[model samples]
Target: MRPLLLLPLLITTASAADAVITYDEHIKPIFREHCLKCHGEDEQKADLNLANFTAVLKGGSGDKAVVAGRASTSLLFKAITAEDDAERMPPKKAAIPAPQIELIRQWIQGGLRESSASKSLVAARDTSFKAATALNFDGPPPMPESLPAFTPPQLKRPLPVIAMAASPRAPLIAVAGHEHVRLLDATTQQEIGALPFPEGQPNVIRFSRDGRVLMVAGGKPVQSGSVVLFEVKSGKRLTSVGDETDAVISADLSPDQKLIALGGSGKIVKVYGTDDGKLRHKLTKHTDWITALAFSPDGKSLASADRAGGIHLWDGTSGGILLTLAEHKAAVRALAWRSDSHMLASGGEDGLLIWWDTTDGWPAITNTNAHPPVRPAGYYGKLPNGVLALAFGPQGELLSAGRDKQVRLWAADGRALKSFASETALPLQTSITFDGKGLFAGDAAGAVRFWTTAN
Candidate 1:
């Protein structure tokens, strides 16, 4: 009888140790004991009701309480683990026990499972984009022939252009406008058509490598966010990815068009499938808002940068970290990979432009004053020196715009070739034409301008 009782006790202990940590089984009990008084059915604080799993995920008035795959970045975890007595949860009480806090961490890191029978709500699929031998096109490049027409949205004022992209294979330019994308001809500089983005203002616009599709990514800040894709020819909405709580700040589609990687104020890089829109990978390594993202043209590497100046190169398919290229001391504003995938150029608020050799992740060329400020005659407070945008030409040339109100060109070997001054309005975005004979730029004053290459 004693032996049988001991065997049952042993089995129960083993089962408890191995069972999944879930909201219903483990988390709710803890909340009820410690959190329910101020955040439950009867009473709510900070517009937060933590009586159920949904409410917990919905978060309070601020950022989301629990980020699905990252416990370290979750607000709930921070609240419970805070060092200050006043800011910590259960306000005046001691912090949660270490073991219980660990359980919460596991619950979040395990995709916030509600029960043992439940699937992970934020599981990443194993997917990768395979690169082709070369970016070769058989016929004339894809162009919008008969796109469906749409009325452009009327704005209170012209929205400041936030993003822009030039088609790699076509004489086309996509410019972000107020709740719409304006397509323009690179040669004539005339409006071709408009695509409505009902989601919100677009913060990032990108054309696929083959120039067959365009992607627009953004949404209402602190409310919702997403990425929308469109067929360049028919203007058909291809697909949308992500359901984020804040606007997506940076995004890029892989050269093969099989994967889309995006990041936002959430500080997480999410790669999703273009066909099915399922999340493929969630990279939570950045400590600040992601400011830039780019996939190598050859489709092997994905480079992402953050507001804190961190940059990481990842395997395009597996989402594994390949290298951490750390040189910039301020926000990295733009990242552009060379066509051959051998080099990457990064511009940052530190006023430095660096070209990294992908072979060993070393800075091949570092321009300390890529866009030196030109202050006016007697105004000596400080002039803007940040590199705001970057684009690469077909022949390895580079175009960059800076907060100094100048647009400049550079040779493949880091030689300064030409410079165009914007005079008043700051140039915010830039793109080079396919033939490398023209330049397109959007400025802070809500103007999109074009220039021919100087003789």
Candidate 2:
């Protein structure tokens, strides 16, 4: 009887055992049960995919999850083996049992073989990859490739506008003002809607990634802080979150519309879950008030700027501080993350725009004084008079607006592209928004304007 029991146990551990643990049969189940619900099929957490062998190798968020025969060095294994409870994988739950853990180790050691169950997941991942790869634009034929003289547009309004954002799927644009928020048609320069707020002036207005929600932040005069969300088409109020007494200086949404990051109140960067308006994480690391927050395109990390001239990188899920950058000389006000690269673009009050390569953990790209440097008669100086807002166009162009009353476009590499100036004399403080087809500008007198390339 003892010999028969030994034979069965030996057969179970043998390489020819019927229950072969391949990437499809054993490893995928491990991920589904212990990993994927957060970082797998439903969502790509940490920019990683465990749904298939290919996606596991392609990696996500920051680094590769698997390294072929090196499970001990793989980020996925490292996360799962984290000694610190907060750093452990499937975070917020107990560690996986040892037998299940050994299966992952054996799978990694066996070259991570894939089975039929992984085919569907691999096909889905490949489709997404191909779609992203096939996107190519000629960029308006390079505008004849010459040093065209800068010509500022003539302004029709007299007051200043602060910030703006355009809807991705429509001609609608939202503009921020002293005491009102206005929506406009990007093609006709027509005011579509004007909503007034008596509680406080708005500091910024941005459209959600899906274009279904618009978020407005500002406090009324004598009242300091608040943030509001409204339906884009009907102008109906959706919900308001945070203290009305704490001024929300800047805000942005995650790429998937699952989170909102609010910059306000004593260096706090509050991240809220969009589904229930619940506080997900409150990042407290900046020494001064936060001025800007931008999530990376993959949605695993967040970049934040502050009045203390600091920029920070945070892990989106755990809210852990990953990096702190201090290259700006003054308050950092504007920040934009490139959609396909590990680079961050920032503008500061010191009249400079710099791009940092997050991969190298240093300032790898720089564009000093991004605004037009010369001031002609009735022309604001080159740099946005004050870098009040920054955004990325559909084709990845950088657009920025300044207190000096101008909006300038820049190539992804930080080269100057174009500049638009209103012909008016009111010291513009303009807000600019863009759709793939055109650019929209809003000014202080509650006027919105549009510009586009002639077809």
Top candidate, metric lDDT: 1
Per-candidate Cα lDDT values, in order, are: 0.83, 0.64
Local accuracy of candidate 2 as per-residue lDDT tens digits, 1-455: 00111111111211122344588677888888888887767788677878777788788867788755445557887789777999988889999987888788656544566864432111111101111232233332111112223232334543356667777556667776546676666666666566554446677677765566777877753457767777765566677766645677778777777777887656888888777888889888888988888888777789999887888999877789988876676788788776554667788876656666676445544444454344668866444335656776656677676655666666565556666664443222333343445655556565555555333
lDDT of 1 by residue, 1-455 (tens): 00011011011111123457899998998888889999999988887777899899899898688987556468888899877889999888878888788788778766798888888665453111222355577778877788776888776778777999999889999999888899998888888888889999899999988788999999999988999999988889989999999999999999889999999898999999998999999988899999999999878899999999899999999999999987787899999987777778999998878777786676656675778886789997966689999998887888899987878887776767777777548899999988888887799988877777755
Positional deviation of residue 409's Cα in model 1 after best superposition, in angstroms: 0.2
Query: Residue 95 CA error for candidate 2 (Å)?
Result: 60
**Which regions of candidate 2 deviate over 4 angstroms?**
1-159, 196-198, 221-224, 375-386, 403-405, 425-435, 443-447
Task: Work out the TM-score per prediction.
Answer: 0.70, 0.59
Each prediction's RMSD over C-alphas, in Å, is 20.6, 21.2
Off by over 4 Å in 1: 1-134
lDDT of 1: 0.83
